[model samples]
Target: AQSVTQPDIHITVSEGASLELRCNYSYGATPYLFWYVQSPGQGLQLLLKYFSGDTLVQGIKGFEAEFKRSQSSFNLRKPSVHWSDAAEYFCAVGYLSYNTDKLIFGTGTRLQVFP
Candidate 1:
């Protein structure tokens, strides 16, 4: 079965520090990869996605992800961190099952931004 994995369960970064959250996926063919952010008491927000065309895709809130086919990774990155950035980040991959679309999400990586 196809699945997504976020190795780091938690990460701490100071304000204005560069951040990178690792994400890996297992799929036979190309999958639709997405990065979503969730803050306390808030719904999930789509950061970015990559299906084809470009390997590197820009996302909202100064975020970006690069899809590396060889590494099967779609890692999220930000040049600087903000206190508001503290939240749970999820990596999801879209799968087509019996004509139905499905999204498999990782356990999630909790980001803690210090001021």
Candidate 2:
């Protein structure tokens, strides 16, 4: 079965510091990869995605992710962190089952930004 894993349960970073959120997926073949952010009491918002082409994909809010097939990882990164960036980050992969596509989300990584 396809699965997504976010090893980091929680992370604390000082405001203005660099941030990196790790994500790994297990699938027979490379699937559609994605990164999403969820604020408290808010729905998840798409950050970035890797469908094809370039391994490094740019996303909203100063975020970028690199898709490494060798590592089976798509790690999200930001040069600088902000207080508002604090949120639950999720790595997901789209899987096709019986011609229906569904997203399999990771456990989620909670990020806390300190001023």
Candidate 3:
């Protein structure tokens, strides 16, 4: 079965500190990987995605992720955390075989930025 797991249910970081969110996936072949951020009552916004090519991919909102095939991981990272960055982060996997663009999201990791 194809699925994604976010090990950390929640994470807290001081403002201006570095941040990293763990993500692991189980899928056959190279599945499309995505990181999305959602504020309360807001829709999911694409942070980054790995389809093919370079292992490292850059994304919006000063976010980046490295796709490690061996580890089956696509971890999200940021140099400095901001209070506004506090939100729910989700790791998602998209099926290539299915035409539907639906995404399977992880339970999610809540980020709390402390001043």
**Candidate 3 structure quality by residue, lDDT tens digits, 1-115:** 9899999999999999999999999998778999999999999888999899999999998999999989999999999988999999999998855666767889999999999
Task: Please give the distance, in angstroms, between residue 93's alpha carbon in candidate 3 and its true position after superposition.
Answer: 0.8
Q: Per-residue lDDT for 24-70 in model 1, tens only?
A: 99998889999999999899999998889989999999999999999
Error (Å) of candidate 2 at residue 44 is 0.6
User: Which should have the higher lDDT, number 1 or number 3?
Assistant: 1
Q: Residue pairs in steric clash, candidate 2?
A: none
- What is the TM-score (0 to 1) of candidate 1? 0.96
Residue runs of model 3 more than 4 Å from their true location after superposition: none
Q: What is the lDDT of residue 3 in candidate 2?
A: 94
Q: How accurate is candidate 3 locally (lDDT)?
A: 0.93
Could you tell me the C-alpha RMSD of candidate 1 in Å? 0.9
Model 3 is weakest, by summed lDDT over 10 consecutive residues, at 95-104
lDDT of 2 by residue, 12-79 (tens): 99999999999999988768999999999999999999989999999999999999999999999999
